[model samples]
Target: MGAAAAAAGADPPPSEAAATPAREDQQHYVAAATGGVSGESCDAAAPPAGGGGADDAVEPVVIDASAVAGGAGEEEQGECGFCLFMKGGGCKDEFVAWEKCVEEAEAAGPSVDVVELCQDATAALRKCMDAHAAYYEPILRAERAMAADLESFQTEEAASHSAASALASEEGQR
Candidate 1:
């Protein structure tokens, strides 16, 4: 299903669960990147893990605020203003409506068409956020700038490494 469908809580078609036979306890992490939601850019190279030269690294924006906040027990927030609405920041009532719809759909079982059922709630939430674009636009712009800087830095680093490797090879041949 598409983003709009998923956002609307549409039930997924046929599960590969029977074919793949996933463990019941296995967890899944789904990261959705919707255009104009968080920022304008697509996913970029992740920052190098562990300690690196602070000056050379571009810190990643914390996208999942719930993770940083300690978990579901804590306040859920997101990196962007549009997402903040789901955490009781803005458009909260609309978000709650969507949340409720999804919960109800899920309780109805896998056969139910959650997306079809929740479209109204999803649309309501979407409308609310659209109305508040003035607050989120600048934040999203900043995020896009940061993502661009990160991509540039990664490109430069790759070039630098290639040049250094060439120099090392030349010296070894001498």
Candidate 2:
């Protein structure tokens, strides 16, 4: 009968239970979500519903408006007048006149004293024209080429528009 009862999965006797350890060894596995630690397996004794971990309380990043404005102000001041004119923001006509003067100055290729002037300007301009003569020369040449091409394109566009108008008038007469 005892064998039959054991085979039938009868409960162990109270004496056998008393002989076993009071606490069994336990294993816990924790997983992270969104690359952050899971809250559920934090500890056996959990914190209050609204409190504890710094991760639970998120503070939004704030930017100072005055700091942002100051940075923008500096950027604006740093931009050359020619760049502003090219971008269609309109700069002082004196800047365009100064560019023309530079072109004339380059044709003369700077007198010894003017070369010295360029060296002096370098302290304020961040580049010495005489030192970077090759670089600036190519840039000026490219600007002139671009201006000529733009003028040619505009002339061609105007001629095409006039021709189209003439053809339309002739067709209407028919």
Candidate 1 residue-wise lDDT, 64-113, digit = tens: 44342455543332333233323322455776577667768877989988
In model 2, state the lDDT of residue 173.
100
* TM-score, every prediction: 0.33, 0.26
**CA RMSD of each candidate after superposition:** 18.8, 33.1
- Tens-digit lDDT track of model 2 for 1-174: 665334223221222112211111000000111123223111111111111222222221121223223544522322321222221212123333333334445556546333343333323222222233232232234445566888899999999999999999999999
Candidate 2 to truth, TM: 0.26
Residue 163's lDDT in candidate 1: 100
Q: Which residue window of length 10 is worst by lDDT in model 2?
A: 25-34
Q: Which candidate is the best by TM-score?
A: 1
Off-target runs (Cα >4 Å) in candidate 2 are 1-134
- Whole-model lDDT values for every prediction: 0.44, 0.32
